[model samples]
Target: MIKHRFSAFLLSALLLSTGVMAAQPDNVIRPVRGTIDSVKGNAVTITTRQGEKLEVALTNNTKVNSVSEAKISDIKPDSFIGTAAVQQADGSLKALEVHVFDPSLRGSGEGFNPFESADGNVNTMTNGTVGKLVNSHGRTMTVKVKDQQKTVIVPDDVPVVLIAPGSRNLLQPGTKVVLHGAKDDKGQWVVRGISAGKDGLTPPM
Candidate 1:
């Protein structure tokens, strides 16, 4: 009877360990963007451009950065850029926002991946170069990102921005922030890091 009890206990422990590991989040590659509605203690509330409200908990490990305004003319040929775009039915990407990386920041977070878009539609992040540009009808540019090329439509209203190092003090009401984090075991959003734009600058990536 003792041997059977010991076997049962071992099985239970194994199950518990498995559950613990499953509860923890894996690597975070999803992107979160919105306006800071409020900041209270270790929690921050944000309203996305799509009007979805998100309250993410902050931890001591959260990294923060600031962003500044940029111009579309700044994007030259071979200029490395990261943009979050929504795929359209016509097989083109509509630029939600664009981030022009400095020469020193080239190749940072390079690749295409699924992102948490503000509109709740499937979105992707493309990090690459401006292969070609056209002036007819707003702005059309062909971007070579990763191993693929996407024709991006840059509307007149899209905001372009530049990235700069920032601090936690940037987390104030009305500030724009792009968050990257994971959900905890309780299904609560926990921030790993944040990029808050300064003076109305939006974090495009």
Candidate 2:
């Protein structure tokens, strides 16, 4: 049993781990079971019969439907819900999942957001000095990151949400970041997300 001062939901699977006496950062593999105590903007507050309360965060990925595919209503204070709760480092009950008739809030690992779910591995990545974008071809460009002019294959899956220097989104000989959409002949590198410093169009060599 993870020794928690409060009676929040804890994962049964991980409470009994050996060698580790402290509760895992997140071992609640399954969702917590409880009743909806309150409903907030993307998050819902649920309270179990034992007076344990938890707040669950929901995104597009959360499964909020029920087995019958019917939406839950009322969400009575005493209704039963299978829930998974975690005591966050900040000492808050984090609802892993909530089961209700409507089930419009099943935890999809941690809820869902389209922009966030689009690419899990993609983050705001930056290369040193940020190379200048030089138009090598139509709608295609190339530039050396930082200082090295080493030939690096641009990836297509990247999402260049923003470009450095300005919002022109134009790829020119002096453009710091080569933000163009073109695939390599071998079809391996695809330049999608690249950022340049906030200084100017051309990066310092």
Query: What TM-score against the true fold does each predicted structure earn?
Result: 0.65, 0.22
lDDT of 2: 0.28
Q: Best candidate, lDDT-wise?
A: 1
Candidate 1 local lDDT, 18-108, one digit each (tens):
4211232323244667899998999899987757778899998887767888887776778888888888899998889888876776876
Per residue, candidate 2 scores C-alpha lDDT tens digits across 177-205 of 31212233553223232223233322110
lDDT of 1: 0.77
The TM-score of predicted model 2 comes to 0.22
Off-target runs (Cα >4 Å) in candidate 2 are 1-30, 69-205
Error of 2 at 146 (Å): 48
Clashes of each: 0, 34
